[model samples]
Target chain A: MKIVFIFLISILSVAAQLTLMPHLSFLAATPNLILASVLAWAIWRPEDKKEWFILIPILLFDLVAGQPFGLITLSLCLVFFCLEELGLIIFKQNDLPAVFSLTFLGIVLFELFQVLLSRLFAVWHLMEPIRLTAFYFYGSLPFNLLLNGALSLLFLWALNKSKIFQNNGPLAKLK
Target chain B: MKDIDKSKWIKFFIVLAVILLLIFFNFRGLLSAPKSWALFAASPFLKLFQVMDKGVSGSWAFFLAIKDLNKENAGLKSENQFLFEEVTRLKEVARENELLRQQIGIGQAEQQRLVMAEVIGYNPTLGQYILIDKGAKDGITVDLAVVAANNFLVGRVAEVNANFSKVLLISDSDSLVNAITQDTRISGVVKGNHGLGVLMEMIPIDAQVAVGETVLTSGLNETIAKNLIVGRVEEVIKKESDIFQSATIKAAVEFDKLEQVFILFP
Candidate 1:
């Protein structure tokens, strides 16, 4: 059942990323809703899932987004692992400010990884790393972080209402 | 027993290892088969979305025209009459030009193979690419140059699936074209300017060039042909003591207005 929910979210996000973003894109950057949702899940949910759930979406994004196969998957997995550690050591779960901060950091890391990795692995990415990095940080940070927050809130709400996160559910014992 | 069970971190690591292997295979061209299936699955939704988007935009345009119908109709009537007279004069001039060309023994260039396509998707994060509806099934392979209205170079087909392909616009950071100034013949390499515009770099500092001079492909390379208008020089950036100079460019095609493009298979 949870797998079904994850699959739905992944497909919808990929579809939206491909079909809807061009109409709404400004300055060539848009908030990545799937990245935010998965980061939120990694930070807020217990560490048992290991973001194995998001691997499908990352792989799908690779194929559809025209990025090098496995680049985003690797980056998302690394982000998931880092978020797990950050949650364990500092932020912990259920903290609003922490969640927000995590979302911001997650986006930073996500874009940074993408840009740097594209420069390294992908064909023909010669845009100055500093300029691309600065655009995301200065030009897009506020709008994207807000959107990421809203998406995280929706994910949190959905996870909260799910029976799997409820008492006597599979995750409850892990919690 | 539970303590001896495999940990999630271990599981995650295992997946990461597999992904890394796939990345290695990607460099070997081994990962394309699975990716083709993914593209095949996504193509239907992209087609549906393109249809719906066109419908919505078309209706919006209709209402927008309705708002200005009276004002535009009055102007269009006079413009139509002027265009009809101008076209008649231009046709006579064209006939004379063709005669002169024949006398000089210049003939039309060979017909180029073209495949028309519709813009179906754009992903800015993937370093500036748009998905077009025509693909391998439509004879669009990689490295074919795409042109918009007036033969303006829009991009080149980067990746192709069965029913869809991705065009990497010249405005993308990774894109490079060998270009020269049309008026002065100052040559340089044009690169995408952070997805906002393009930059012509690697020109010698002493070269004479001016803003608004046309830049066209030098045809020094096999990927893109010669004499295709790239952009008009927007800004000339010259620095003393620097070996090379650069210019900002404004591409001719209005990308936001792009809907149809032709792929030059030749």
Candidate 2:
């Protein structure tokens, strides 16, 4: 049931990302909905081994994406793996600072992976070569960080405040 | 603990293998059917969210513009009267031109066939593209030129599925179009500036150009038609040492506000 819930949320977020998020962009930066949701969920339930179910949605995003196939999935998986391992080793609790820090790092890592893969794919003639410039990194990084950070913070606050992840809620067993 | 660690590694390898397979299949053109199916399944939700977004944005815009409604209404009323007269004059000229063409042994000017499509999605993260609700089934093939109202150049059809297609916006970094200035007749390559804006590049260093001159497609490219408005020159950048000059262009089309577009058929 939890797996199904994750799949549905992922689908909805992907749909919103492609359709609705563009209208909400600020400073040429749009919040990455799937990335924020996955990071927040990982922090909320670290022991949830069914997280791999997200790959299904990631595959769908890749299919609809303009970039080379599988790049988004691979990049996101690597980020999730690192976050899970690092959280276990460093942060014993899901505190506010830890959540913000992880959110910031996850966004940066995911974008860096995208840039690197885009360059590699260009070399392989998968698409046109992306020009790497300082503006490419600095132009939208501040706004991107702020948007995704705010989203993660909101998710964390709601998880801690609501009874959805506690007591007799549907996902209490997973929690 | 050992079992958990084993499963994690197994999952990682499985993901890696899947990625490899996807890349291979995508490059070999084997993923088109699956991709088409995916787009087909996701199209309804995309269209729904797009309509919702338009409604929300429209209401917000109306709320914000309430203060200036009187001024805009007065301006639009005068502009509409001028356009009404201009249309009447153009109709008279068109009738005379048709008779002249017939006398010159030309039967008639061929009319351009355009297929109108609604934009359902915008991808700003991975690339600058908009998904339209028309595709191979509607004769929207790859590389077809897309235009907004007033014959303003938008972009080209990048990829096509059965029920939808991806239109790469002219502001995308990968987009390039052959364009020429209206007055000066100086030709250049108009390229996207990483989605920041559009730039007309590769102009001859000695060519005479100025700001506010309209840029149009040169028809040098087969896919795009000539005389289609690309944009107006916003700035001119000339250097003594450089072989080619470049200028920034201000496109007439508001890419963010595009709800519908027409695909030009050859």
Candidate 3:
């Protein structure tokens, strides 16, 4: 049942990405639907189970729609583990500001890792790095944060309203 | 319990080692991994987005149709007419020069290979690539020069697949071309500035470079044909202390409006 729910979430996220959020590009940046969905799942689940379930969609995302080799899988795994470790304290005092800050930081970290890996692997040249301006980083940060936060909240609310999250485990109780 | 912990660490190390090996082979171009599958899968989604963009642009065009576009079109037509006439006159002079040179026993040039292609799409993420219809099957190879209808050098083939090729425009940060001033015989390398223009570098500061002077490919690498028009010098920036001067060039082809191109095969 949990596996089915996770699969449903992945489909929903892909659908949303294809429809409503297609035009919302920040220069060369696109909204990372897979990352946002996994982050949402992690925030709503137990630590150990979170990593395992998150890895499934992430690897699927990587296989179906990602660059060569393990770029997306590695990057998404890193982000998931980092967020899971911080989820205990962060979720305890969750607010709009906290969510926004975490989303922004996650985006920055992901982009930084992408640049580093591309350079180190010679996939992209070191001389011509993608410019990360304050305007670019901070400007769209709020809007994306609100967008992801709202989507996560809606999913959580839907789970609770349907009581599908009940009787699963302690992680489902959080949902 | 101790053995289970050791096995977990071993699994982790193995995964890490595999990832590193993949990255190494991917960079060397030895592996034909499914990198472009992501783009292929996302293309349907992109098509939907393009429809939205077209709708928005269509509405904008409707509003501008009444007054602005007509006026702009008129101005553009007149300017184009003047430039077309000037090019005709220049062609006549070039023909006469060729005849005179032939009479003086000048050698004949090699036949150039030209392949006409259409622009299919632009990669939004790379900002530096223009996808052309021709690819490996069309005899398109990496480093092959791409030109416009007017015989102006536009870019070069960077990445090629079975049915499509990516052209790296002259405005991309990674692009470099060996060029020479047609009138002055000054030679230099043109490097892209990731913007609207290119910079001709390594020209001696004292070289006879002036605004409006035409630049052409030197064909030093044999990748591009010699004497293919690239652009005209727009501005010359000279540094007294340095041996070389950098000059800005106005590319002959307007990249933003490019819809068609021709790839010259080796």
Candidate 4:
């Protein structure tokens, strides 16, 4: 069932890339659905011992997209673990602040991670124009937050409707 | 409970094995291995996706056709007038050369090798990269310059395979080119600012840099030919106590509208 969910998320991410987000760029920023989905899964199933599932899509993203290897994987893992710990505190409720804060942190960390890796690799000079980086971060922050927040809520909603949120075991009780 | 624990370990082992295989392939650089089989397997689905995207773009284009047609018509009329004037100017130059007994130096340089390529697809996940139809077999190599119509430098080849090559646009974060002002001879490095625009850095603070000046490649590296059209200076920035000024460049080539490019062979 987790495998099926991962496949569905992958298809949705590809579809979003092809259709919904074509030419929708905020200064070079686009919606990161794969990142969002992986975060969602990490938060949804914190105790599943299936961290590799999160790593799979990230590896595929790096491979198919031609980014430096392990870049997205590293970022996603960091975001996943951070959010998974945060998820422990907020697990009882699906409130707006919890969702928005987590999504916002995800975006910030993802961008920071990319910049840090690029700097460490000597891909681009650091201390270049801060305006460009500032514009991209401030410009895309709200939209990314909203998009990821909606996705997180939707995932939580689905799990709740399916009774997975109420179950404390590996398998959710069927309705 | 013991059986459940055993099953969990088995599942974990399977997942771990898959991850290990992926990591091995990634480190080996085999993740980008020839995609002949995968392309064959996924062709049908890709075709469907293409059709859907085309349908969406087509509908939008249809709605805006009238406005676009009028703009195109106006552009063509001015271009025709400019061409007529250019023809007369060329004729005058030829006549003067004949009268002065001076040899016309036309066609003395090495033959220009151009390979025409179509951009069949782009990776949306990778915002600053594009794939062209021509590849290593066609003499495309890493760092080869790519230009659009009217000889505007668009990007350089970043990755090459048998039949396809990827061009990294100037808008990418990693792109940096040595460029100079066409009018003032002021030199600087044009670096991609990732999102807002490209910035020309390290220009001496005393240089008379102005907005709207044309920037061209300096050919300092011998990788990009001299005087290639890079961009137009949009803004000049000066900070107090700084020894150098930076300028923002508006790239001449619009990367978003790119459909075809000419890859220049070394």
RMSD of each: 4.9, 3.0, 6.8, 5.8
Sort by DockQ, best first.
Answer: 2, 1, 4, 3
Best by DockQ: 2
The two-chain DockQ for each candidate, comma-separated, is 0.53, 0.66, 0.19, 0.21
Q: How close is candidate 1 to the true structure, as a TM-score?
A: 0.79
In the predicted model 4, the residue pairs found to clash are none
Instruction: Please give the distance, in angstroms, between residue A121's alpha carbon in candidate 2 and its true position after superposition.
Output: 2.0
Model with the higher TM-score, candidate 1 or 4: 1
Over the stretch B187-245, how does candidate 4's per-residue lDDT look in tens digits?
Answer: 99987775447899999988999899999988884567777898899999998799999
- CA lDDT scores, all candidates in order: 0.75, 0.81, 0.65, 0.65
> The CA-based lDDT of model 3 is what?
0.65
- lDDT over C-alpha atoms for residue B101 of model 3: 81
**TM-score: the better of candidates 1 and 2:** 2
Query: How accurate locally is residue A116 in candidate 3, as Cα lDDT from 0 to 100?
Result: 66
Greater lDDT among 2 and 4 belongs to 2
The residue-by-residue lDDT of candidate 3 on B1-266, one tens digit each, is 67855765565567567656755665575433343443354445545644665577568778878678878899999989999999999999989988988999886656677889866445323235566767677888888999998789888887776566678888765688999998899999987764436889999978979899999999895788888898999999998899899899998986645668998866
**Model 1 lDDT per residue over B83-178, tens place:** 899899999998998899899999965677788898766777657788787878887788888888677888888877767778888998778889
For candidate 2, lDDT tens digit of each residue in B1-266?
78977887788889788888888988887887887777776777887887788899999999999999999999999989999998999999999999999889988877889999988778877668888889788988889899998899999998887677889998887888999999999999998876678999999999989899999999987899888999999999999999999999999788888989999986
Could you give the DockQ of candidate 4?
0.21
Ranking by TM-score: 2, 1, 4, 3
